[model samples]
Each structure stands twice: as C-alpha cells, then as structure tokens.
Target: MSSSIDSQTAAQLQEILVGADDAVEFLSGLAGMAAAAVSEAAGDTIECAITLKLHRRPVTAAGSSARAIELDHVEQALGDGPCIMALREMSTVLVVDVSLDARWPLYMQKLLDVNIHSTLGVPLEISGGAGAALNFFATRPDAFSPDVYEKAEAFAAAASNTLQLSVRLRTVQGRADDLEAALESRTAINLACGVIMAQNRCSQEEAMAILTKVSGNRNRKLRDVAKELIEQLSGSPVRTHFDT
Candidate 1:
C-alpha cells in the first residue's frame, strides 16, 4: 500500500476523520470516501466497497453504494473476484472488461450480470489485523485509467491505516473484557471451592476435585457449576462459610 495520499485527498480524509469517526462503524465512512475519491479523480465510477476479513471470512463492512455491497457478497459467496486475488497476491488487480477477463471466469460473469464491466481492487495494509481491500466498480469497460488507479491506491492506504487503528482499538477492548471475565470466573471457582472445603471438611484439592466431578456429571462448564453452587447457597439459612 502506498504510504501517503495527495494533498487534496489528505484534506478530504482529514475532514472525514473529524466527522463522527466511530471505531466500530468507521469502515462505512472509509469505503464511501474511497469511492468518492476515485470518482473525484476520474469520473464513470459507479460503486465502491471495502472488504475486511474477520475469522478468515470476507465481510463487506461498508460500501459507497448498494450495488457495490451486493457485488462484494457475490464474490464472498463464490470465493472468487479481483478483490480476493488482490489480497492473495498482495497487489492491485484490475479487470478491464469483465467479459474479456478470463482469470476469474465466474466472478467476471457475475460482474457482467450486474452491469459492472470494469473493476479495480487495491490491497490494503491492515497491519497485524484482518486482511483488507478497497474495490471500485465501473459500468464502462476500462473506465479507470492508470493514473486514477494509482490515486485510488493512495486512498486505500489511508483507509488501511484508519482501519488498523479501529481494529486494534477493538482488540484492546476485547482483551480487557476477556481479562475481566477470567478474573470473575476465577473468583467464582475459588469461592465455590472454599464453600465445598467448609461443608465437606476437606482440603482445597479435594474440594476442587468434587467441583470437577459435579461439572462433569452435570455436563456444564466449570464456571457454570461454580456459579450455581454459590447462587444456591447464597439464600440458605444453613449456609457454609463461603461468605468470605
């Protein structure tokens, strides 16, 4: 991916960033920006889409137009497109005329069916995040010139950087949530073991063993079993010393 955008696009991108750039839904704006950028650089651009691979699945996170999003779904379902090849090749792939493009025959046919004759896919740099690409579609054959393609590449790079930051933000937030959940699970299990220890007058190891058996017998997760034990004993009058 190119590292920097031209001054004009940089200014426009900055405007987009300043306008309601939410972490999770930011891709929609970025995809729109990509299509608008290419359109501004060269006319005849019909649609644009941004694809982000999550858990090894391609999702059309955002699009400049509905048709762009539809084409993305078609590519995902069939597992073929210039966009997929761009990501796989880690480079730009262009289908000058869908009817004449023989590399991805099925994908080309679908494009023709949609009245999208030309397509350009630019690989993006997600930076330790999901694989991504920016795709543009045109109704006319060879609608995008080499210069326009280069300009769109710069926009793709910008989208990549912004997307990477958003993805990393989500990752950090997810890790924090996971840590909190793990801590809660640990506390629950420890409390359950302590309760078992008091009731059975057994060692901590023996209490854990008993808990494990209950978990297995009930076909439940250890944490679920632990939580149930604590809940069950909470309102009991003859409760053990698990209040600590």
Candidate 2:
C-alpha cells in the first residue's frame, strides 16, 4: 500500500530524523508523530509505541506517552504480544478485540486489565538484519478499522527509510566515539611512557615494559594505569589534542 503520510508529515519526519541527537531520540519523535497522525486519521485516541531490535543489542522500545511506554514494557516483560508477533513474523498483527483474541492470552489479559481493548502491529522494513515495528493501542474494541489499517501501514512504510538512516547514523557515531576513546587511550600511554623514560633514563621499550608490568601488578586496564601515572606527574587527568 502507498504511504498515507502527507507532505507536511513527511517533512516533519525528516526534521525529526536530521534534528534528533540519536536513534533513540528519533524513534521517540517518530512514535509521537505517528500517534498523533493515526489518532487524527482514525478519529479516535490512539497511542503508539515503537519496538526496535538491532544486531547484538537488547530490544528497545519508545512510546508516544508514559502509558504507552508502560504498556509496551508490559509486552516486553511478558515476552508475547501482537507487537512481538509482528516483529517475529514480519507482518501486520491486528487484535480487533482483546476479549476475542486468543493468540496471546497473558498479554491480552494484561491489556484488558488496563482498558486497552484493541491493538495493531505493523512491521517496518529495516535493513541489516535489524527489526522494528510500530504498535498502536486503543481503548475500544475493533478500533482499527480498514481505513485505520491502511493509514498505519502507510505510515510505517514511509517511516522505514528515515528509521534506517537514523540507525546508520547511530552506528557511525558509535564507531567515531570508539575511535576517539582509543586515540585518547593511546595518547595517555605514550605520554606516560615518555614520563617514565625521562625519569628512569631508559629507552622507550624499557619504559613501555615498566608500564605494562605496573599495569599487570595493579590489576587495572593498561589505559587506566597509564592515565593514573600521568595524573600523578601533572596533578590532573591526561588530555589529548582530541579533547579540545
């Protein structure tokens, strides 16, 4: 189905994608916008929550509201729900009425207890073995009419590209952070080795050996030991050029 997102909504989603500080923030904004759009289209109050499963990472969830977040957590904690099923199956899962749905008894009961009588789960198309879904909750039974389903599906489709871009940006940022940390660690070790060489009148290799021995004896990370040794000499923590 074609995306139901209007040009204005598309612009808003793009704004969230570029303006958000990270993937989590982007997902939160997406959930809020999705909830608002779906609620308007359906002419009913609908709450949204997004579930994300990235490679080698624990599943994460974001919601449009506190109650929506709490409900998503309830599904995550129980380990079974329309949203989970949708993610697992990579298809839409609709519970027209929590009272009639028998697929997830425990989860449905939990939703019923909280007066959420209907739910719709739409899988998002994400690349690189990552999985995601947009989940909607409503208080009345059969809240997800055919038109609502179309709108939800369209929103999910339109969101998939931006979400993929956000995930890639997050991955790149993580790599940059790791590289910066490694550079800082290497700088500290080099500076400490210089100090040791100057004080002990030894070669660079001997100074490095001494530092390694101290690190092993102290049972600390090599970087931590190097940082501590440098701090002792300067009376402050080591700062590399990157720190500025």
By lDDT, the best candidate is: 2
State the lDDT of candidate 1 residue by residue for 113-232, as single tens digits. 878989998988876647998888999898888878877887777666666666676688799778777777887899999999999999999999999999999999998889788878
Q: After superposition, how far is residue 63 of candidate 1 from its true place, in Å?
A: 2.2
Off by over 4 Å in 1: 1-24, 54-59, 99-102, 235-244
TM-score of 2: 0.85
Clashing pairs in 2: none
Q: Write the residue-wise lDDT of candidate 2 on 152-171 in tens digits.
A: 98888778887787778778
The positional error of residue 200 in candidate 2, measured at the CA in angstroms, is: 2.5
What residue runs in model 2 are displaced by over 4 Å at the alpha carbon? 1-7, 21-24, 54-60, 242-244
In model 2, the Cα lDDT at residue 51 comes to 87
- Error in Å for residue 11 of model 2: 2.6
